[model samples]
Target: MKYVLEIENVSKFFYGLVAIDDLTIKVKPGQIYGIIGPNGAGKTTLFNCVTGIYRPEKGTIKYKGEDITGMSPHKIAQKGVLRTFQNIRLFKEMSVAENIMAGCHTKSQQKWYHSILHTPFYKKDENKYWKRVEELMEFFNLTKFAMTPTGDLSYGNQRKVEMARALAADPELLILDEPAAGLNENETIELTNIILKIKEMGLGIMMIEHDMDMVMKLTDYITVINFGKEISQGVPSFVQDDPRVVEAYIGSDDEEDEV
Candidate 1:
């Protein structure tokens, strides 16, 4: 089957230290793929390479059968690929609705002159984007916080805003880095449901997360990486049972279980 994203022998390094060592992965549309590993397993590094924050030292990356290796981040994002950071990143002073509207600017039709002159077309596109922002905020349960400054919202709500912003870009593939990092159980569960909803909309979702229960519930397939190498990968059930996965990451879950 044709894949939405294909990474083949992709490698990256910093100061001669390998961050992604000949790693390969494939993601299909409507699939939720998880990347799990220890803290230094090169998960985020791989994301950086994919998003063009770092150019890969070797190998190829193809999206929809088109090679996109080493493209600029904004250029890549324009192609319907969007991501949320492991650390929450949002405009602290921007209203929740305004933040999401910024994401839609990439899809806005008016040119610089139109915006500068406040032309009728600018007004039209502005209204269109505003309506879109409102719809997304309402969908993510952020309607009440629509006018609130993003920094003033609770951490969980800020995260939801970020996801909403990413979705506002109309991504075909969404990459989330450690989306469940600091959430409480209830918040995590809610986030899980939201992610499932996104998947149902047919976006390819990839994430790097430490929360095993959340990852296991949300992902269709998972790849385990340790020290910049792939040690295990498959459906969640199979990866959960693999000895190598146990030794590397899942074993920690067992320890948490014991505690």
Candidate 2:
């Protein structure tokens, strides 16, 4: 089905403690898949496995139909899989444009020697990336702060900049961890619209988030995990109605019978 990512029966452990167990997910082109669960549900761990931050001990991770299980993170990224963290991970002292340009190196064809010698190949490629960087900045509404240090921008603006940097890699699949965290209602709404625009560009998205309203509104499908197990998965409506979801996140009203 033109899947961009296929994860099957994946599992991970930390000192014999299972962090993810038998997890399977398939992401197709232009799909926005949501990963939601309560705290400590191994959502981030799953992202790590997919992105190669932490290798899965079992099963396979396939990107673009190639097995990427345990591949180095850079190799995975070079294959057009990119992600953003829940915690802001921008270069605080760098200008907004510089931070994004850092992500463009992977796309350049010029070698370090060419750059050092100021060869035409290096300058030509450098100019192309500069234009592309401006395009991305304008696409994400960061042109006004192009020369500003990322740390000087507002929290919401900083978040946007981080996302722009990730997109600078020109990925086919974007994995976002809590992109809406810490933003006010207005900022969240803006972020929502921005995500919609990204979807229009035909990029598949896999996101780990806690904002129920955002998840309900933006995701085409939802995967609910708890304590490293996939408890429920489907559209938002079914996930919201699933009893296991309630028990895992909202807690159950019924108590155990007396032994």
Candidate 3:
């Protein structure tokens, strides 16, 4: 299978403290890949590196066979890579529809001069993007809140808005950082359905999540990291049974329960 995102021996450091150390992983096209680890295990750091929030100190990252190791965030995003933060990062003052519109900026064809002069092409593009925003809002079941301020929505709704915004970019590979964080059980289940829907749309996903139940249910493959290094990786069941994975990540009690 063709891999959508590939990282080989990638490492990153902050003031001499290594956050990710010689880590390697790959997400195959159309797969829901899971990255699970304890706090400070560098899961978010890896996401940052892939999304160009932080440049790795070593190794290479390739997206669709192009080297993107040190590219800027905007450049990487333009290549169809998008990520959400562990904490919901929404334009609080913006309406839900406006927040989703932000992701369409890269795909907009209207020039600054066109916007300044209100050209016909600019109006046409604006209409097209607004249609897209509505489509995205409907996809996430957020159409009712389209005109409401983002800050007025509940936590789960905010997360849905974030996902909708990311989808507006038309990304091929979406990296989600703890998207289920702060969500209720029903909301998490809803998110799982949305993720699978995205996979059906031919988008590859790499998610950093702590809810093992949700991960096991949604992921095609699992990668476990501990202390900035990959400990084990395989199909969910295989990784769940790996003893080293249990000792280093999943506690022995959970291992026994699985057995």
Q: What is the lDDT of residue 221 in candidate 3?
A: 92
User: What is residue 148's positional error in candidate 1, in angstroms?
Assistant: 0.7
Model 1 scores what on Cα lDDT?
A: 0.91
Instruction: Give TM per candidate.
Output: 0.94, 0.97, 0.94
lDDT of each: 0.91, 0.92, 0.92
TM-score of 3: 0.94
Model 2: lDDT equals: 0.92
Clash statistics: count for each candidate? 0, 0, 0
Candidate 1, residue 107: how far the Cα is off, in Å = 2.1
Report clash pairs, candidate 2: none
Candidate maximizing TM-score: 2
Compared with the true structure, what per-residue lDDT tens digits does model 2 show for residues 90-122? 999999999999888866667779988999898
Candidate 1: 10-residue stretch with minimal lDDT:
246-255
RMSD of each: 3.3, 1.7, 3.3
Summing lDDT over every window of 10 consecutive residues in candidate 2, give the lowest-scoring window: 250-259
Kindly list the per-residue Cα lDDT of model 3 for residues 1-259, writing each as its tens digit. 3889999999999999988989989888889999998899999999999999899999999999999999999999988999899999999999999999999886676778998999999999889889999899989999999999999999999999999898898999999999999999999999999999999999999999999999999999988988888889899999888887778764677667988
